[model samples]
Target: MLKIQDLNAFYGKSHVLRGVNMTVERGEVVSLLGRNGVGRSTLCKAVMGLVAPVGHVEFDGKTISGMAPHDIAHAGIGYVPEDRAIFPGLSVLQNLELGMKKKGQTGEKWTLEKVYEWFPRLKEREHTPAEVLSGGEQQMLSMFRALMGDPQCILVDEPTEGLAPKVVADVAAILQQMAKDGLAVLLVEQKLSIALDIADRIYIMGEGEIVFEGTPEDLRNNPEIRKEWLEV
Candidate 1:
């Protein structure tokens, strides 16, 4: 449902993404796995129109390279950054409402009630300030906030960075449920194991380029592919 072809992005004079090509089919979970500084996040940023790139970012079908960030977000895509960007002072419900704004979207499936159903923790702390949430709670809130927009595809950057093992497992479960429920998920994760647990296909990136891609089993069995691009 999303296509990125020959994508090249630069941060001023520093080029971050080099000829990155990948696609996410409807209801499929495809993950981009790589070590630090490999432009994994940059690829997502470019696709979401957060970073300027020189190529094609087609969602459904139309090009959205030069589109505004809000326009891109409103056009059936949701982004959850690696940092889990949340409003510290705002309440959990308040943070969630930020994504509820509907533009040209129709036939929505996610609402505050649905969000509460998916994440009862957010409901429990609905009136508490975001700063009071634990690390896992913050991560949960971030994911649910993106869901509040009712996006067709969601881009998640390292959803299990600093969490405990149990939290990581929870994240994997949530992402897998999203895929099973017919949402295209593009996950960028440093922890290949966590991603492989939920990802249907994997893209191994090295130095801002995709070096290998296959099913989870193919990646697990190839020693050379692990040696070249994934060992950290």
Candidate 2:
């Protein structure tokens, strides 16, 4: 549902992404894996128009490069940053209600009720401030805030970062459900197992370029790629 080609990005003249290219098919869970210093996050930021890039970013079928971040969000793309951007003082319900996107199809997948179904804890804590949530609840809150947009595609950067194993499993399960609901997911994660669990295809990125692309099994078998991009 999204395609990025020959994209290059920079932060204050320090180029991060170097002619990167990748595609996500409808309903696909595509994972982009890389070491800490690689440009996985940069690529996601560039696609969402949070960072400047020179090249093509197409969503569904139109070019979105150079668009403002708000316009990109309105174009049916949801982004969950590595750092969970929850409003510390806002109630859980209020936070979720903020993600009504302008371009997504009106579907049954991500209504407030539906999000609560996926995360019953959210229902239980409807009035709680975001700062009071545990790490796992905060992660869920961050995701629900974006999902409430009913996005056609989601860019999840490090959904499992800084969470416990059981919490990671919970997050992984939600991502699987999102894929099952036909929303394309482009994930950038450090945990190989978490990415492999839901990703239909994987890309190993380095120095702003995609160095490897394959199925989960293919990645597992390529010891060099695993050692280099993951297994840190």
Candidate 3:
């Protein structure tokens, strides 16, 4: 589980992520939705300690706000950035190997074989260089690589950005399966329909703060909140 309270971040004099508060319980999928420039990615970076944070970020009941990124990761949090961030020259299998918490240590919950079973495309391309894979394949690789670390929770940012509809559906299904398997998932997404379909709860952000917190049904019923904070 993850909890963030009064979380704030800054880029020099410009403040982002103003006093944000949220939680992700185990077996839950919580989506953070907002338009561009609203600090959704900044919140992920702050929680991962890539950005300096001014408030509490607790995971499994201990403070992780100031910890180094690697340390935070070792404490059981995974991050999949908007940019996919795979190693271009490395083989697909090699990139996944690098995700292990310790070199050669495949943790209990996730293994290379299990990942292959989950996504056969990855198995087919196991020996191929990562740079040659399609965008959707690359995205799947990114998520599975994080799973190689055996994290208790994952912070996923924009997982379906440029994929085709089918690929987006695949990604959404994988995220839901992750929640069923008991990993707390914090998804920062641009696709409203995907978020609404898979998330147990939703938090809408505007101007760097959470403006709405409710279930997907509540969000569906609130047209005003959608118009003000979410719609383009």
Candidate 4:
């Protein structure tokens, strides 16, 4: 339940996102795929209120464009950035504990226990300092930390940037499970196969605009679109 219409973003004097329009429905995994410098990650930051944005960002029918990052988060949107922002000194458990919106908040679907269940490796390192974890582990920590907020929608930017194949599979499975659990997942990924495999709908972005919107099969079948906008 997220909608973005005519959205624009800028860095200094250079414009990044231009009239970008997209939507994500409940229980849906929508992938924004493009090569580098197309503004995919900026779109995620714009939606999360991490960057200055113009136009409308509506979540569940309410506008969130001008809201602060925490305000947008408390409104039921979570963000997992490409760089895993983990507190180096904090223990895994402490990091997760801080992830909660408020102490002992109930009625939320995700919990520390549930997150641990999803990634048992995180449970194993429960008391370890976050800085010691591997890249994959750090990524898991970042995602689980966001889930600790029990968001209705999660904007995940480059979830599988640099990881082993098995770890990438794990991350893909987790995103798939998130959709099955009725969370709207907006994934900005460069990996074509992974995105096509998990996304219910695919939006191909180019130069701050959506060039193609279709299903996985449609993307696979369209060589022209792939060659021009996607292939290196």
Candidate 5:
């Protein structure tokens, strides 16, 4: 579980996240939807301690606002940034191996074999360099690499961006499976349909603040909110 209260972040003199409040409960998927430059990715960075935050970030009842990124990660939070930051020079297997908190320490929930079972393409390309993989494949690799750490919660920023429809569907299925396996997922996505389909709850952000918080059905019923904050 993760909770953020009165979270504010800045990039030099420019304030990005403005008094944001949100939560992600275990075994649930919460989607944060917004257009470009609405501070969605900044919220993820603030939660991960990559950006300096001016409020509380609690993980499973413990405050973690000012902790180092590595410490935050060791405390059971995983982050997959929008860029799909994988080691291009490393083999797929090696990249996954690097995700482990401790060498040779298998997680109770996620393992290399389980990840491969979920995405067979990864297994087939185990020895191939990560740079050679397709964009969708690279995204999958980035996400599964985070899972290798066996995090209690994951912050996925734009996981489906630039992917084909089928790959986006595959990404959606993986997020659903992660929730079923009891990992809290906080997804920052631009795809409204995908978010509406998989999220238990939705938060729409605009001008660095949350403008709407509701279930998918509530969002569907509120055309005004969609037009004002979500639609392109």
Candidate 6:
């Protein structure tokens, strides 16, 4: 579980996340939705300690605001950036191996075989170099690599951007499955439909602050909120 209170983040003199308050409970999928330049990604970075933040950021009941990124990860949080960071030269298997926390860590839920089972495409391309995979494959690989760490919660930023409709549906299914399996997912996404379909709770951000917090059905029925903040 993750809880953030009065969180603020800055880029030099410019403040990006302005007093953002949100939480992701265990086994829940919480979607953060907003238009561009609204600091959705910055909130993710601040929670991951990738940027300097001022205020409280607690994960599993401990303060993690000033911890190093690696330390934060070691504490059971995984991050999948919008760019889908993967090693171009590394084979799919090798890329997954890099996600391991250590050589002998045990009791983990994710394994190479399980990853192969979950993603047959990854299994087929197990030995192929990452550079040769299609965009959708690369996105799957990114999420798979993060799962390799056996994280309790994952912060995913823009997982469906630039993908075909089928691939987007695949990605959404995987995210939903993750929550069903008891892992918290803080999904930062731009696509309203996808977020509405999969998220249990939704938070809409605008001008770096949360403007709406409600269930997915509540969001869907409220045309004014959709028009004022979400609709393009």
* TM-score for each of the candidates: 0.95, 0.95, 0.98, 0.97, 0.99, 0.97
Which stretches of model 1 miss by more than 4 angstroms? Answer: 102-107
Q: Candidate 2 on 111-176: residue-level lDDT in tens?
A: 877778878998999999989999889999999888887788999999898899988988988888
Q: Enumerate residue pairs that collide in model 3.
A: none
The TM-score that candidate 2 achieves is 0.95
Preferred candidate (lDDT higher): 1 or 5: 5
Instruction: After superposing candidate 3 on the true structure, give the runs of residues whose Cα lies further than 4 Å from its correct spot.
Output: none
Q: What is candidate 5's lDDT per residue for 1-232, written digit by digit as tens?
A: 7999999999999999999999999999999999999999999999999999999999999999999999999999999999989999999999899889998775789999999999999999999999999999999999999999999999999999999999999999999999999999999999999999999999999999999999999999999999999888
Model 2 / residue 88 / CA error / Å: 0.7
Give the count of colliding residue pairs in each prediction: 0, 1, 0, 0, 0, 0
Q: Write one digit per residue (lDDT tens) for candidate 4, span 1-232.
A: 8999999999998889999999999999999999999999899899988899998999999999999999999999989998878899999988887778886662267887788788999999999999999999999999888888888999998989998899999999999988988999999999999988999999999998999999999999999999999999
In the range 102-184, model 1's lDDT, one tens digit per residue, is 54332367777777787788899999999999998999889888887888899999889899998888889889888887889
lDDT of 6 by residue, 1-232 (tens): 8999999999999989999999999999999999999999999999999998899999999999999999999999999999989999999988888888985442277888778887899999999999999999999999988888999999999999999999999999999988988899999999999999999999999999999999999998999999999888
Report clash pairs, candidate 2. Answer: 1-24
Predicted structure 3, TM vs. truth: 0.98
C-alpha local distance difference test of each model: 0.88, 0.87, 0.95, 0.91, 0.96, 0.93
lDDT of 5 at 182: 98
What is the C-alpha local distance difference test score of candidate 4? 0.91
- lDDT of each residue in 1-232, candidate 3, tens digit only: 7999999999999989899999999999999999999999999999999999999999999999999999999999999999999999999999999999888888688899988998999999999999999999999999999999999999999999999999999999989988988999999999999989999999999999999999999999999999989887
- Report residue 201 deviation for candidate 3 (angstroms): 0.5
Off by over 4 Å in 2: 102-107
